[model samples]
Target: MNRWFAATTAAALTGLSVIASPAAAAQNCGGPDEPAAIRFAFAQLPFEPLTGAKWDPTPVASNYDPCATLSTILVTVEGATGSSPVQALMFHHGEFVGTGTAKAHGFTSLDADASSDDTVVLTYKTPDESTVRYRWHDDRVVMLDPAPSAE
Candidate 1:
């Protein structure tokens, strides 16, 4: 009976460890308003490309989910000349992965469709209007659609 008790206790402890592990804790993407998540997203922005740009104090939109393996924060930053460019900051497990649009250009507006947990559809209101889908694959944010040409 003592041996059985020991085995049961060990099994239970092992299960608890797995539950408390970071991998398990990261299962939920957490809320969009999570302070830590917001800070992480802002810290990852490519400042070189966004020099002299001003963005809202708050994020326009955000999505998080570990099942999808990708998370995102959308921010609209206006340049000194009044050109508003919407930037998609990508993340994986709360770490900044990359930007959805590589070029530094202005778009009239931007929207994100995160209907699926694993991928996000970003639409940009440019002269022609364009859409791009992004996902986390092979440790990076991969654009499923053709990237927009730099203006």
Candidate 2:
């Protein structure tokens, strides 16, 4: 078989489901059968694809948006400082798009919804069984409501 973006064509794009735990931050990609795990290593984020013969990320949740022009991958990573459990990451066309983060407990899952104006609406789920709504732009994630109001 042949593919240009074969490497990027990995897993599903379902929302995340996080449970708060004292255990170290980790990303469960590829299964025990496979042996490749991508660690943040440092606080600095990665913008490229991690392809290793040793491991294949049988990711728990993923969301690939065709509407999103940039070919991006969404993953959760822990901070290098070890302060936060996990943070949502977006890599587009092998370039770092942006990231979304929450409290120390960390975010478990995420889903993106594109708006008519181009802004993306991301719904983040926390371990506490709470939801955070945000308006995502090209470079930042702003906490805002998507509902229309005023009479």
Candidate 3:
């Protein structure tokens, strides 16, 4: 084997192994809004606060865990600008935790299941629009539905 070829192949294989390995645990994992993170655990996200005119908050998840001290609440806030649009925020124990992808649309109706520990599934109904389900993990609320076609 050529000397340079063997060295290059060994280096390439070593790099591939590193890429395939799991990332090291974070000391403090931030929420989904932590910005451009490739990996984050669910427990890192707590509820976030939301404030706006014409906004309404309902504790859909709390219904299932009514007796618990901490509950998940969903808030629908009217957008302040075109770029901002409407915002769907989730809170726990009155503290801001996270936001949903329901931006630009008001989520007037909400339902959630709090049975599973460390996870909550929230569904929202928009007036005359497609409904969306957001999976609430420790760090973020992810939209389960496929986005509407731009066409």
Candidate 4:
């Protein structure tokens, strides 16, 4: 009687496993936003490419100023020893906004040496017009519209 009971329990467990298999699982990963894609004009360097970079756009409350809100972005990339031309990250927000590169300013250019651990700084006028600048800081890439100057 014990042997028969054990066999019956095993069969029931096997049936449950089959019902809970991945083949019967749902497809969606669990979120509204799709995974972002990263593309570079040049080849990717060592380490890992910037994957979990985040951006936050400030909410526009009342006045209809052209540039009301601001956006903050941040990401980290690997370093390269020798000089190699490199560019990365194509940002798409509602429209194909633009691409940001690690430019060492007056030094060589975006296509000169890879700027590792450099935070790409961008100032957006209205999420449309913007400037992409790179720096050697591992902080947030704060994008803000220039404040009005005193008359």
- Top candidate on TM-score is 1
Kindly list the per-residue Cα lDDT of model 1 for residues 23-127, writing each as its tens digit.
555644443333456566666655536465655445666665443467676666633334666677666766666777766456523344443655777766555
Q: Estimate each model's TM-score.
A: 0.61, 0.34, 0.34, 0.19
Error of 1 at 92 (Å): 1.3
- List, residue by residue over 1-151, the lDDT tens digit for candidate 3: 6999999999999888775543311111222221112112123432223433554233222322222222244433333332222444443323345555534243333444432433444443433355555555555555566642221
TM-score of 1: 0.61
Candidate order by lDDT, decreasing, is 1, 3, 2, 4
Candidate 3 Cα misplacement greater than 4 A, ranges: 1-71, 76-86, 92-95, 102-104, 113-129, 147-151
Compared to the true structure, candidate 4 yields what TM-score? 0.19
Q: Local error of candidate 3 at 20, Å?
A: 49
Least well predicted 10-residue stretch by lDDT in candidate 3: 33-42
Q: Better model by TM-score, 2 or 3?
A: 2
**Predicted candidate 4 versus true structure: per-residue lDDT over 14-63, tens digit per residue:** 98987665433212222112122122211232333343222212211111
Off by over 4 Å in 2: 1-58, 66-84, 91-95, 102-107, 111-128, 145-151
